[model samples]
Target: MDRPRRCVLLKFGELALKGRNRPRFVNALERNLRRMTADLGPIEVRHRGGVFIVSGDMPQEELAERCLGLPGVSVVQPALRCERDATAAADAAVELLRELPGHTFAVRATRRDKRFALRSIELARLLGDAVRVRLGLDVDLSNPDLELFVEVDHKELLVSVERLRGAGGLPVGTSGRALVLLSGGLDSPVAAYRMMKRGLRCDFVHFSGRPFTSPESIYKAYALVGRLDRFQGDSRLYVVTFGPAQRRLATAGAGRLQVLSQRRLMVRVAAALGERLDAGALVTGDSLGQVASQTLPNLAVVEEAAQLPLLRPLIDRDKSEIVDAARALGTYDISILPDEDCCQLFTSKPASTRGHPDDLRRIERTADIEELVEQLAESAELFHPTLEERAMVSAATPASRGPSLG
Candidate 1:
């Protein structure tokens, strides 16, 4: 008997419904999968109808877990490649079941190749009887303690007992590129993840209260970006120190409109950076009425300052939903770390919820908004969080420079 080889069975969700554009989406997903797992070792991806079979040097379970984070993938099954016969599949199933603890089990077989002698039900029944007779396990169809899967393809048969859920959406870069206004907060990182799920290849921009404040928030933002980079590799974070700019806003007698004015400037600076990076729009974590600065009126006032379109993925979502997503995305811990965010500096105790466009424009004039935007853009520091060497391009002052990852 030949030894069973481990492999991953990958399936996509929405990409399958793409009709004429399905191949393009699948190709994009393939490229993304390879890039995401390049560190693991070389891998081969073979497309068979709707599912893809990936074989590589890395452990199958580890490879499946890594592929789960990739967008466009719906399900990942780590299985053993066996001979294309019922006896081989039942043998593989018994081998897999021995490692998994379950008294009751169900065999679910899918026969994609008609050339197979037995039907799908026949294969399932054979495996189900084998597990029942040989392993002393009962069969439960509705709610089983374990679900053993046997997939029959043209060339081979795969048997497994576990199915991992993937990050279901279109492939990253399929929906074009956008820049996320990533803050050291709960909402923005979640917002960036949401956009990435929608296939937007997103880079991040973080505004830090440097010079007037400590580098704690910059470190937090750096950590946050590093966490998010796992979903979409080669993540870039541009940090702009805005303490001086905020001080100017405060001295301009903006009063209750201080936070609103600061937010507008941040958007302007982000838009400036976005232009150079060719980002079509800017993404934010604004949940409607979540804070005074996020009120509808204030949000509109801030949106006017952005040269590119502003996308708020969490606008309609409540705080709880955003928090839950943050926890799941693995950024909640980093975001909750104490740090003085740039917008929090020079902010009034009670910010205006209904900030008028004219008043913000007037404040912009007093602060020389365009010139300030230009300066902030020029001083932006670029960091690639995924790279362990702490590779960065420093265009800002020494104080604005990020701390060593070590």
Candidate 2:
């Protein structure tokens, strides 16, 4: 006979506290899970109590990796389903424990279905003796080398020897959509990841220094979005040609305020794009004092250009923290790639650390700000990395299944 299908148990952490909006958040999480695991195979997702039970004939390792990228998921465990009986639960626990590498073990039994005869402690004691006798594994209740978790819910029982940590946060799409100002740098990608972790579904808008610079930045942006799409399943990137605007600012002699002027323009353009995409806000990688343009005064001046809310996820994080986050998100190597992004093309002296509103107004007068924003909005190129394309890319590259951030 064929073996029983492997199952994964998904637990929601903060989503359970959503009260009235719990259904909506749970639905969104279910939809995201379906999309993320579509390539795996035919699967079944059932909501029992507050837990999501996923069953399919796929590799648990791959499923766990995909689950960790999903927001709202706190834990994913490869589980075995059995009838709600003490002997069956003990058999399942012993079967799983036999495969795990551990001499000391513990059985944690949770009796969610109170109608069952035995309580949690009684069930644990009963299963513990059975496991110890069958597997000869010493019991370590305080700190076990391996833990076999058993959950009795209604008429079913699920048992697992290991539970993997998930990407804990609100489910993506539960918060809303935002357009991230994606740059070919470490910080922006990390910022985007942070927003995603907070349940924001992010679309990207990358400013490319094409024509005047190499296409390396554009490629880097593509790679970064590709990496991020692994989390969201689908992603859209809008590449806007920004060299003309930079040259225009240079020709108009913006002086020391060039960087600040460029930032304001980028914000305006991103705001325009955000409107078109119906994004709730604009996300950037600006950390306080990280760069000259990121100073408090310049940030304030630049904020005036955005019509919508501006979210800087990395505002207070230092460089080392940002780099570590980037590495964890798998974008550090790609971000470290040499590229002439729009921010690097212009040669200017030390930028003003405190850009005044009057200075911004004077700089705005040199260029038709409204016209430039409109032009960028009209001339941007959009790219959508579909699920099939992403799967193809993953299959072609053997390293796509490398260690997950979690």
Candidate 3:
């Protein structure tokens, strides 16, 4: 075996403040991280001195790639995670700068263990002072050419400056579960992301158009959510074919009414899925009046069927703002993939901008909406994101599956 060119270190940040619930939270985080990086190498997760360390045959750069996006992680700087001598420490610091674009930099050390006779400030100054004399560098604290931070733990040491970008929230499965209405569009996935950032575990309810609609669009939406789960860790998605119902309503002279009717059915389906799956609410991308179907009056008609709380995380956000957030979280590229969602099935005249709930109920009675619901419920496919492959596939695929809600 080519000797494992891997790096070992601990992750700490917000978990420090967590009291009794700390172990439960870290266990969930460590599990998710291992799942995401499993294929790359045999990654190991351990708890030490109020932090979790992952070690194995994985490079610091590649391992850092997936570790940064994990929730509950605050700092991910490189570490030795083992005992070190002064020569080793000094050599590591010097070697770090040797491949630099410039030669002028300093090393700052902090000794928390106190086993080292040289005090923290004393050791830091000497490291900097020695580097200045040996490498002809300048010591600039406020605005240094570069900074080498050495954090010494009991038996190990970490040396590096490539800081990891954490998800900066509580771990997944911490807050309660919620069902996300994932569309291939930009807003819904962004909505799911914002909620996940707040520690809300999510199960996506995707309404796809099948038989009448091509499989590509549904695949595109699944792919989008999967990308996020790769960043997040474990997420489940339910793919329900609502096309026959949507088509039936359209053919029944309800083209103008199809959008609202389908939405009510979506809410109804989500409510049942939530009940079965322990999800607390239904989250959507329905921004107020963003489109004809999302208008204030139309929105009310769409939401009339739901007994559960409807979470519109992006309700007040402008499209531009949602798009910016999506791009930052790496969802924008997949959201624009080559496919169309069920929403593209109709282009009605005037498109019912101002809808009345009572009228919607009357239409539902006349249109036999229960039949639509029956067809939709029977066709639903429960899909969870595959964290191992780092990609989304149909639930039927042998992949890294999650809890089944059926």
Candidate 4:
């Protein structure tokens, strides 16, 4: 047998059905798996029996944690499994279960290893019965305090009792890097998750309309990113102060174009930062024709501000879709937190549904938005990932040194 740390099995859902797209998704997942682990160490991925098995001497749990947005992967699990010889497999299960915290137990088996000659139910019962005798614990088949799960693959039978909740998306950094125009809004984070599911590495460039708004908003925004950063790599934040920029642009008679102008500036800031961050595009969590600002005309005006490609993963999506995604990605709770962001600052009464590029171009003629942008960017706060030593997230940075308030 190989060393104990030799292999970790990565099982995927949703990607299995697409016969042709499957390969591309697999390739993307592999690339992301590597990028997220660039700081970790070496690892190898092998494809067998429709599941990807990762082998390495590095931290399997850490690698698994970093793989929240890995494309094509539904879940990531680290475990040891072998041929389904009931007596032997049960013995291994018993040993592993003993290492966990609590003990009232049960074993669940999913038999796809036909050669084992036992139904999944029977296999589970046999293993459960064996563990009960070995560990001297009573079994509550309905729901034992501790569950030992046995998943039977074609070539191997995997045994694991505990599963960690993963970021539960595609691998981060697989699709390409994208600088998300992350407003501290409920929708944008969810949108970022949608894009990440396709394998995009995301870094946030948050725009703060400071002075007009308090730093508390930026704190809220970064707090939201902290939750997201758990799945993405290192959770880096680039804060851009839009206060002076917005004031200058607005004083120059940029009223109807205020929102559009602000968005353009944000796009420009994100583009510049994206280059520095090695990101490929800009992502916004806007739904199609939902808000007055999101109307086709308004969206076109705002999008023109960015030189790089713009990705609106949530553009065509609905509120239900956004909420569902938010809830599923685990950003829902924090997003609903009572923290205010820049968007709430200028809640325009009767906001614009149609914005003309001509108006934006006209505004560009007066106020030097770019110069203000430069000044703000220069004065911006920079942060780095609180690098950890172990594969598992033993600890994270304290909230004190985290991203500053708006």
TM-score against native, each model: 0.92, 0.92, 0.83, 0.67
**Candidate 1 off by > 4 Å:** 387-406
* CA RMSD per model (angstroms): 3.6, 4.7, 4.8, 6.7
Per-residue lDDT over 1-406 for candidate 4, one digit per residue giving the tens place of the 0 to 100 score: 3212324666777656557566776776676667666777888777765567776767666766665445556666667656546776787687778767665887777765566688888888888888888787788877678888787766666777656544445555646788887787678888777777777878887787777776654654666677666455576778887776777777777776677777887887778778777888999987888877898988888888887899998888889878888787666765665544565444445666787887887787788767765666566666553324112121233235244343
lDDT of 3 by residue, 1-406 (tens): 1121236454656767889988787777777677768778887765666566677776777777767777777777665543455555665666666666655566678775778767778767766766677677787777777788776656656566555657677777777788888887789988887787667888888887776676665665667767777655567778887777677667656667767877887898788777778888889999997888898888877777875788888999998999898888777876776555687675477678877777677767776877666656666786655644334434443232223333
Per-residue error for 178 in candidate 3, Å, reads 2.2
lDDT of 2 by residue, 1-406 (tens): 1233468999998887888889999998898899888888877998986789998778887887778778889988888888878888887787788877878988888877888899999999999999889999999999999898988888688888878888889878878899999987999999888898899999999987767886667666777887888778679989898998988887777778888888889989999989999999999999999888888888999998898899999999999999998887778877887777677567478778988888677767778788889999889888875433322222223234221111
Model 1 lDDT per residue over 175-253, tens place = 9899999888999999898899999999999887878888777877777787778777789999888888999998887
Global lDDT scores for all candidate models: 0.85, 0.83, 0.71, 0.70
Worst 10 residues of 1 by lDDT: 387-396
The lDDT leader among the candidates is 1
User: Alpha carbon lDDT of residue 267, candidate 4?
Assistant: 84
> Model 4, which residues run further than 4 Å from truth?
1-9, 13-72, 75-156, 159-170, 344-348, 385-401, 404-406
Which residue pairs overlap in candidate 1's backbone? none
